[model samples]
Target: MNAILNSARAELLRLRKWPAVWVTLVAWLLLASLFGYVFNYVAYKTGGSNFASEELGNAQIFAALLPENLPAVLVQGMPMFGGALMMVLGAIAAGNGYAYGSWKTVYTQGPSRSAVTAGSLLALTLFVLGVLLATLALFATYTGLIAATEANTIVWPAFSEVAKSFGAGFLVLEMWMLAGYFLGTVARGPALSVGLGLVWTLVLEMLLRGVGGLLGPVETFTQVLPGTAAGSLVGAIASGDPSAMDTPGVLNVLSGPTAAVSVGIYLVVLALGTMLLIRRRDVA
Candidate 1:
């Protein structure tokens, strides 16, 4: 237990000092703001229509940016860009150790490999939590300002709803991060791991999902993919009207419980797989 704690602390310190980690977090914030508030708010003010606001009236657009809808705004972007950035974070966090030969040094002199691996995973989980909290804070600030400016009541989302959204967002981000970590371990480097993970998340999954629409077996297989599960979970939380959803990756393929369970399974499998691979293989 002590070893794990110490290892976690060490990993956290390293991550804290890493520039790439902050850059990824900042990038996500910018994206969430641009899509969640900036565009919609602009369209509402100008009575103009964009992709997201095309179907939404000015009233609806303005309402979507209020504090009451913060939970939805928070997780809507997680299925796509949010997950991809997290994957990059995870890939680099694990793969960079090999690039710099730090893993070899640590494994040679540190506690058991299991302890070190557990520590690293713990640290990564903490980082994911931080990202969510930061995003929530940013969204609250934006919405609060908008509500005050518009003289609208600042109705907060229900505690239960916020908790549920937070949990779902955590699951989606952590799953992708762990997937990246597993890829990094398998590839033994960050470059290939990050590239392949991004392609899988951003492109390949979408392509397969598109083809799945035409083929029965392919559609069935895509139901279990990470992107599908993530999108479905977000879709379930967001409005149920599929036609109203203009977000790129949000889908309504599976039930909420089913998507949540699949995401949980992926999270567990990826974490365990990365640990097993690192423990059994040669770090040197």
Candidate 2:
């Protein structure tokens, strides 16, 4: 346990020193800033439109689009800010180990394979979580500034709503990181993992969705994909009011319990499967 903890700490310290990680952090902050300003700008221009997201399972109607509210900003800006970019960030973080031969050094220090894997996974996932935290902070700061300066009403989000948003963001971020970690571990390079995640999420997923729609019934298949699952999970939590999704971008509207279960399954399956595969394969 101590060994694993130490390895996790070491891995985190090492990842913090990564230039790519720093670059990603900067980009994430920029994204949060951009989202905050742009969305608030929309509200600022429109004098705060009353466009609310509708519910999926609750049969609720649309409410107003409140830019001053934290939950509203999270649900509205997440598709633009987090999704694919964060996946690439996760890929870069995990794949860098093999790309730069960092894992080899860690293994040489006599840590057990389980400990090393656990530690690396813990560090990488937590690192992304830190990024998400920073994202929220920056976004909140920007939105607050907008509200204060632009004369928009500062309608605060309920504690439950903020909890849901955090839950959704955390789940989405972790799943993306795990997916990238799996690719990084198996492909053993940054390029393939990063490229594959981008291509898979940005291009292939959309193409498949298009083709699936044409074929009919295959839309169900898209629901099972990691990206879909992540979106669904976030949609459920981020829009806790269910009716909060007037123009929910790519949110699946899956019920909260169902989406939560789907996310859990993806995490557990990928984590266990990756561990098993790495145990048999040569990362070096």
Best model per TM-score: 1
Candidate 2 lDDT over 1-284, as tens digits, reads 98888888988888778787788778767765544345435543554532332122211221222433566456444543466666777677667777888777766766877888888788877876787677667667765665567466776777787777777777777777788778877788789898988788778776777788788677778777776666666666545443334333346646667877887888898789778876777756
CA displacement after TM-score superposition, residue 174 of candidate 1 (Å): 0.6
Q: What's the residue-level lDDT of 107 in candidate 1?
A: 92
Q: Number of clashing residue pairs in every model?
A: 0, 12
> What C-alpha RMSD separates each model from the true structure?
1.3, 4.8
Regions of model 2 farther than 4 Å from truth = 39-43, 46-68, 75-81, 238-249
lDDT score for candidate 1 against the true structure: 0.89
* Candidate 2 to truth, TM: 0.83
